[model samples]
Target: MTAILITGGARGIGRATAILAGARGWSVAINYVGNEAAAQETLEAVRAAGGQALALRGDVSVELDVLALFDAVQAAFGGLDGVVVNAGIVAPSMPLAEMELDRLRRMFEVNVLGAYLCARQAARVLSRDRGGRGGSIVLVSSAAARLGSPFEFVDYAGSKAALDTLAIGLSKELAGGGVRVNAVRPGLIETELHASGGEPRRAQRLGAGTPMRRPGRPEEVAEAIVWLLSEAASYTTGAILDVAGGR
Candidate 1:
């Protein structure tokens, strides 16, 4: 059976992907920083969907936590087949000038640094030269990367742009090693992420402006992400897929 690890798997797109992986009968390792309750709930849902599940607690921004997370997955599953680097955060709307130093640091730390750490470990474990089977690494970036998020979240946008570059560069670096690297950019998704950004209805509010006339569902993005992690995308590498509804 395919074994996968999804960071920030307790909620949002991560949770959706974990449940979907479960339905496909894959062994899933769900990592969360806090909210064990939600993580356990997701864990139960995955098992209910017929997948072997493990709930791990870790803050992606911390190197020790990232290492422990990968180690735990290796210990439990014996090996890993795929990884979804989906843990990220967003702050309230603000112009670049109004953004505080601490906010910028936190944004880059979690979104960029955390992603790089995970990608690095993924390469180490999934490379054919490392004596392990090759696998996939799907980074969950944002449409904001290209859109620039303007007056709203330029910092977040910049951070996501880093992931896009990482996906492109790392894909080539690992292509010969049998590891496929890709990314999914989701736009205006309906999730608790907006509330944390201090705009509870941001998606619903701005979604009407998109070509699709509505915000995307978490499951919609999950489909694209899971596909990137599966053999169906075996020949697809270094691809940055946009899951936005033509926004």
Candidate 2:
């Protein structure tokens, strides 16, 4: 069976992708830093969708945690066929100058360094040169990577921009090995992340501003990620798909 790992699978895009991928017959490993309740619910949803699911608690930013998480998934599933680098966080809304050092460090630690570590591990196990069948790696970036997020989250935006670069570079480095690396940039999606950003109503406030007249749903972004994780996108790689409804 095809086995895949999804970081930050407790809620939002990660949760949606886990459920969708499960329904598609992929065994799933969900990595969450906290929120065991949400993660448990997501685990059940994956099972309900008809796939074996494992929920592992770990901070993706820490090397030991990332290693343990992947190790646990490898032990449970035997091998990995795909991975979703979706684990990330944002601080309360503020200007760059007003943001604290801890906030910036934590932001890059998880959003940038954490993603880098996860991708590196995925490449190690999924590369054909490493004696394993190749697989796909999908990084969940944000539209902020392009728009810069201005006064709200320049640090977060910068981290995601780094993710885009990593995806593009890794795609070329791994294409010959049969592994696909791509990214999905979600716009104003209706997810709980807004609350953490100190603007729970942000999506609602910005919905009409987008051409679609509505903020996107997590499921919409998941659809793009699911496609990238599937054989249907066999010829596609290094693509940064925007799930942003023309925002």
Worst 10 residues of 1 by lDDT: 123-132
Clashing pairs in 1: none
Query: Residue-wise lDDT of candidate 2 within 23-113, one digit each (tens)?
Result: 9888999999879999999999999999899999999889999889888999899988999999999888888999889989999999999
Q: Where does candidate 2 stray beyond 4 Å? A: none
lDDT score for residue 70 of model 2: 82
Candidate-wise lDDT, in order: 0.96, 0.94
Please provide, for model 1 over 1-247, each residue's C-alpha lDDT reduced to its tens digit, 9 standing for 90 to 100.
Answer: 9999999999999999999999999999999988899999999999999999999999899999999999999999999999999999999999999999999999999999999999999999999988779999999999999999988999999999999999999999999999999999999999999998899999999999999999999999999998999999999999999999999
Clashes of each: 0, 0
Candidate 2 pairs with clashing backbones? none
